[model samples]
Target chain A: MDEEYDAIVLGTGLKECILSGMLSVSGKKVLHIDRNQYYGGDCASITPLEELFKRFGAPSPDETYGRGRDWNVDLIPKFLMANGLLVKLLIHTGVTRYLEFKSVEGSYVYKGGKISKVPVDQKEALASDLMGMFEKRRFRNFLMFVQDVREDDPRTWKDLDPNTTTTQQLYNKFGIDKNTQDFTGHALALYRDDEYLNDPAVQTVRRIKLYSDSLARYGKSPYLYPMYGLGELPQGFARLSAIYGGTYMLDKPVDEIVIENGRAVGIRSGNEVARCKQVYCDPSYVVDRIKKTGRVIRCICLMDHPIPNTRDALSTQIIIPQKQVNRRSDIYVSQVSYTHQVAAKGWFIAMVSTTVETDEPEAEIKPGLDLLGPVKQKFVIVSDYFEPTDNGLESQIFISTSYDATTHFETTCLDVLDIFKRGTGEDFDFSKVKLELGEEEQ
Target chain B: MASVKIPEQKVILCGEFGVGKSSLFRRYAFNTFVASNSRQSTLGLDHINKEYTVNGKVIKLQLWDTGGMERVASITSSYYKFAEAAILVFALDNPASFHVLSQHLLDIVTYAENAKIFLCGNKLDLVGQVPQVTDADMENFCEQCHNLISATFRTSCKSGEGVEQMFAEIARHLVNANRSRMELQTVDKNSFKVTPPEDPTEEPACLC
Candidate 1:
């Protein structure tokens, strides 16, 4: 309580924890606190089916389902892209040692009326159940071109400029149909809107490469989830921070972030006071410091069976293309069962989430719920997504953006890296992080 | 230290803040106690890994200390999830801290259903020096708390009294509990029956 910390991180959410761990590993004395005692602030895994029900004001679960202890339903469910930044951070920080990971079973996309497993490679594209004979050939050619693409090689560009050419033009080059473009952009490339097709193709091309590369790693889907839930991620980083001598306090009310001359100076909680130069927290911690940007609607549904046509897969992520549903953003569906140790055997927890565009949020997600068939219990929530109005240069209080509606951590990592850049006044050096991992080992 | 890639178990420490939970953690982890004058509260959730030889097998124990934040309802269940053992610490000199042990025990039972529970009256060195709490009171509290857990230990982080023995006892119990649960783990993963529960009557083996 009396120590002067280099930084005071005030939330155990994934982003804050990562920063805390990284700062601690970088030899910065950090004091991480959370009003909530748990590690993950908003991104916690709620267990004991009855606890989730109680949180929703529902009655205790009857004995029709399996044991309550057999569930680890995530409040904010997300899957880690195998080759994603989060994975890289996990490895670079050695946070991966604290946990076990299971590759997601399938990655499917919603088409006209049905769902289809995303064809990852040439063979899968040809053997795909979702595409026609000639369309399959066109998609295969596109995949081949994408695989041959090299960021540094002009010959791989094939008369097309990825930086200037639009993704729509890239699709047109292969004579791909609109339906195929729908899946390719929203599902494989994991874009949320039509905006990507209008812009340069390089980002989209790289995303496709990330997906294929990650798929190449696990040979099933491009995503990997921890055994229990996304909640373990924050805990893993918290462990990393503790190992590096960072201090952690939970349920301790942060009475005030003492600001001196317009910059954060320290924190006061009850009779104890700790001095710090910089403060980092989530949107909720510094509510007045952030601006309301958007809102997200998430529906957590527990079902006795998997989504039909997912090949009886135990864990899967189904993307509903924004164009298919005529929405501003794509709707994400992520399901994990007892196979991944998130739910009981024969029980599945599927969450449907999307950026809220209209007033009728419940009605907006009808297309997603219809695909879920019958749900045993459904809990719905609409949360405001906020972002810091300005970088913490002035206040020294770096506030992380709210958790996005996406079911993957790509955007989440972008925000984290961006925040790290704005806070450190330097880009987070990947090589330096790896080198530090080696040097700090002894 | 890097993980040894052995069987892993998470053990949680719960109790009031400033009740020597962190002191017990330091004692178990570094084999040293924090000076009382310079002691700082655990910030949030802090953990240290220790490898234990349990029943002829080497198991990694993730000793998690809750930073006295167990009072928060939302975060309490998270600490309990997947925990195989729990050590409920209380300051022997403070009656209020010891009084909250029941609620903390409820958290352990509710989230970590089959976890082995141990009760530790910490700061045991201050028993006679501090007139508020006495040995007779400790005896009576143990008589009641022991009924709720496996065993009770009077520990002093300052004197290193009973800390190692408390952890060793918990480790032994956890190893045995893990072995018994192992036979059922595969079956439990495959079958619909509940993994294992302390109270079988409250929840049927399977289904809801």
Candidate 2:
């Protein structure tokens, strides 16, 4: 079969699927390819637990990890509606029945050196309570104001401007309390440090209103997650894309974008040359591959046992310290899963810190697992950072950096061990933890 | 060779950003789903030609999709000129956008005084979160605004809800308008003999 087509989508992510699906539905022949062996990209799911169990000679999930076996893929509906191609694929492939997701409720807040469980329905109330602890009225008012903004509407220029200044300034102007400010501040961090709010005040207000409204409307409240895992959301889209006449090629990395004048004509993947008319890339990969500047680092940690002593089984936390980590802002830690089908009957926590430098050597970096257990279990840490590389095939380098870069590389690991010791009050044996670094496949 | 006389009808789609304007067009014209978002702005205007038979004669209905977020006042102003019928979409979850429905309706009324206007709320699947905008609410809103429009439908492009009803309403209105135009033209004996237009799908740029 000829590899030539009317349009070629560069990445097999959510956005790529939509662009390719729309063009194909419009009668344009389309082809989609991804560098990763799997199609979902960031949303890809693999049985890492099985691999880890094999390495450790551990018992199977039934014999060891026994918690929630059912996985719910939330956000599937929103993703389908957002992309056009997925809808067409569902209809063409008769796979609509496979699309299902369930909503789960959970919440967490960091206090007294550990994450405290909070009621999902009462998160706003808890936020309000937190606001009361701080003596700032303006911050309180800002939270109330955001709560009042309508999200479902098409926000105008007057809605979402972020030039409002420091959290203190916003608090003063709005007459909000300190507790509310901290809660709002922490929420802002979770949404990636007010990136969307960097607009004008009006635009900022609009986005805050939209965010608030979506929360209220969806019953998503302060936070939400995919029912099963994040991966299921994009996986559904990939399935639909293939059901249509569109073709998705995985494990075939595109070597170069065959650009012709100013427009893209085709791409060279390994030895194969796939041709198309238009190409759409996933937004993250766009920076280095398309724009060439921005960088991203993600860390995943798997624990053999659940964190100790939480009343609720499933609550996630977003930690913002009073000070900086490595000269950056506060450290951001999130507990991804307590117990799920993918992990051995034990609990797993995935903490991601963007502050760690990507280029640092693994030997120089210290690795430590700080367990704040009300419960005890085995723990594993996996840190990956991305930086632009020279090789066309490599694209980016993923390295494990020292937890603290200021100290000598060899001593950095010891600093991390000390930080976790002071932070968690748990006597963890670092000798048992294994640290390894390698290239992370895209 | 005998030739059939075809009547002409005009239909227009209007809505706020992200409300499924392009999806509605694809649904009505091609019986297919066209995924669309507010982020990617519509470059220009889209015109689709559709044909149907009425009273033993052929009739043509031209479906036009106007930009949803075009410096609002400008895009709507240009679209109203030739529009004989309009679909004004409002998002139910977004009350702010729904509030702007009056501005769009007024634009159409100012330009095409006699145009048939239909108010539709897209994303009916999200209705559980955002309650359906009842006919009474629309009636009260329209009464206060003094805009006596045509019909309203709660639609979900995802579930294919209210899509057929919307297209049927427009088709029926257009067919009737065509019959009236042909009758009026027939009375003017000096009018030139008209020929039916070719299929619209044949045009490359017509789809976008």
Error of 1 at A87 (Å): 2.0
Model 2, B1-208: lDDT tens digits are 3964554466888767667776777677666765554334443224566776556556566776653323222341334544678888887666776778888777777655668888888878777743756557777776776666666788877678888777766777666755566577556322121111234233211000
**Per-prediction tally of clashes:** 9, 52
Best by lDDT: 1
**Window of ten residues with lowest summed lDDT in model 2 chain A:** A433-442
DockQ, in order, for the candidates?
Answer: 0.07, 0.01
Model 2 residue A156 CA deviation in Å: 15
B60, model 2: CA deviation in Å? Answer: 42
Return the DockQ of model 2. 0.01
Candidate 1 C-alpha lDDT tens digits along B1-208: 4863365578888887678887888888778876867744554335667777976887677787764433222343445666888888888889898777778778787777778888788887887845566657656765775565777788889999998888888878777767767656645443111111235344211100
TM-score of candidate 2 chain A against the true chain A: 0.60
lDDT of 1 by residue, A56-97 (tens): 999999987688877888988789887688888887776675
Cα displacement (Å) at residue A438, model 2: 46
